[model samples]
Target: MTMDGKVALVTGGSRGLGMRMVTAFAALGADVIIASRKLENCEKLAQFVGEEYGRKALPVACNVSDWEQCDALVAAAYAEFGRVDVLVNNAGLSPLYPSLDQVGEGLWDKVIGINLKGPFRLSSLIGTRMAAGDGGSIINISSMAAIRPAPEHLPYAAAKAGLNALTEGLAQAFGPTVRVNGIQCGAFLTDISEAWTPEVVEVLTRDVALGRCGEPDEVVGAAVYFATEASSFATGATLRLDGGVR
Candidate 1:
């Protein structure tokens, strides 16, 4: 139990890569807090985590895009666990893959609000609590789109690039007490895959050196490592878990 007695809050923990991160933190002996927009979904996930890991799991409904909601989320987690040791800024959205010419302003704002602003708000709210405690780690889940421009996903790519910049900036600003890093994930088999067709998956797989898409668990390993003491010296870094796509 490398993270014994620690507390972790994972946004968007109801499903996908976020869910896997919640499980990983629980397995590492952290009392996990799973938050999302739906209360029922978080409650169900909390029950499962409690049963599987035999540790306290708290679930709270939160829309990370809202600053007030993020504040409430941090307050609830602190109430349950007394402190936040790890914060996984995983809540994000990639609505539709529209080319820059086809993208409307409304859709662009929505995507950026959820993908970039959400993490920024939650990190600020939770990072304060962490600073008060014994310091903590912040893992921002970014994407390869931040490095490689996805023309079809213009808004998403731009937002993720901003998130990458935020990760680095926060690491430097919150140093000596807190560590901030990011994971630039490639292709992972998650609900987001529904956006891709079979042809797209086939073409993308051919480009990956691993010859297949990454699993949710594979990405969770990096999240767990960053959350634990193993990455104590690591900060202002972006770990690429993209099946050697670069």
Candidate 2:
């Protein structure tokens, strides 16, 4: 799991699980590129990483949902660190809707663009460079809703299902040099969880074998595993980090 002398680029790295991953990689001796829509947040985290871990952190403002911004992000990372040894596609969103029929096209496109399209573009660009170079790892952060779709998150679920497929397909496309994998997360008490209704939270907590939602830091182990040689034998696999959701 040692990342000394490596560079990691993480989307949504300003906070939540992404933030934890950025800091973890830094602690392991990897310089980081933190990309998010909020430049201020990214800058703050970057400063913290430099002071706390003595690792270089580059703050880039990017909305992964846009293809142009994704392109710029890749370019910026490479320009800063020369190469990205690890890429974590952790940016995603699932907006609440009152009814299925009320789910408009804008919402659908936004969900798909962020959860599926963004990862695809980033993986294709970065994975190609990684393959051409010394090799790298790409980790897509998916959701349990991908397999167990509900009325509340149908669009989001569909997007994540596509992300799962993307992970497998990309692993094959960039294999032998670059590896791609996914983490199908269950309910986690991140900023997003604050939006979950009480009933929704209760049901998810009851369903999980652990009888509770996961903390943001709990994702560090899986994130580290996929990012380093710890998961060298794993690729095209989606590890369930749902606390044994049944």
Candidate 3:
């Protein structure tokens, strides 16, 4: 799908899946706004996209967990591009804790804030603008844990489940124009996977139909689909990019 002349703003657009998406969109001819907590990482990706794809890239330092920062990101994006044709809520974190009982309030809040709250705030802000403007697409990068909750990642699962619900509700709220969808992803060998033990990796791979974790770029097709007219009639849908996780 060609996104020529369009603008895309992606949160967490520095490393992993977000990084891949930034480049993918740029390659398809969309100017990109890369937002992340680290200014240097975002700048590096922005420079790469500009130099490699010959597309404009704006780097904004933001921690999606904060409401004020989310507002600022939107302001910055609109100020730079005037409009955002695609918005990807890709920033998230699922930190490990010793046990459920040991999940302190700080940890719980941090996980929920980054994974759920941020998406809600960003979507609300940008979706409204998209609905009022020439229409656009909003994609949530969720996890399969949202549906198949595990004790080890209950908080993350809960947050992602909320994100799924938000996807559906927002589709209606911003309908008749702006489209909203979600990508429920399975295990991917991202930077996060570097922490997985050999046994953990084996267990993750053995049960999936694909027989292995996905590469970072594997999710690009789905992301591109939702971001463009390829999924023109698919708002409120949550596509499983999980390689048939079971």
Cα-based lDDT at residue 21, candidate 1 = 89
Q: Which stretches of candidate 2 lie over 4 Å from their true place?
A: 195-197
Task: Give the lowest summed-lDDT range of ten residues in model 3.
Answer: 203-212
Cα lDDT of model 3 by residue, 3-101, tens digit: 999999999999999999999999999999999999999999988998999999999999999999999999999999899999999999999898999
Cα lDDT, model 2, residue 118: 94
TM-score of each: 0.95, 0.98, 0.99
Every candidate's lDDT: 0.87, 0.95, 0.96
Residue 148: error of model 3 in Å? Answer: 0.5
Misplaced by over 4 Å in model 1 are: none
After aligning candidate 2 to the native by TM-score, how far in Å is the CA of 58 from where it should be?
Answer: 0.6
lDDT of 3: 0.96
Please name the candidate that would achieve the greatest TM-score relative to the true structure. Answer: 3
lDDT tens readout by residue for model 1, 110-164:
8888889988887887777677667999999999888887677778889999999
Which pairs clash (backbone N, Cα, C closer than 3 Å) in model 2? none
Query: How are the candidates ranked when ordered by TM-score, highest leading?
Result: 3, 2, 1
Residue 68 displacement (Å), model 3 = 0.2
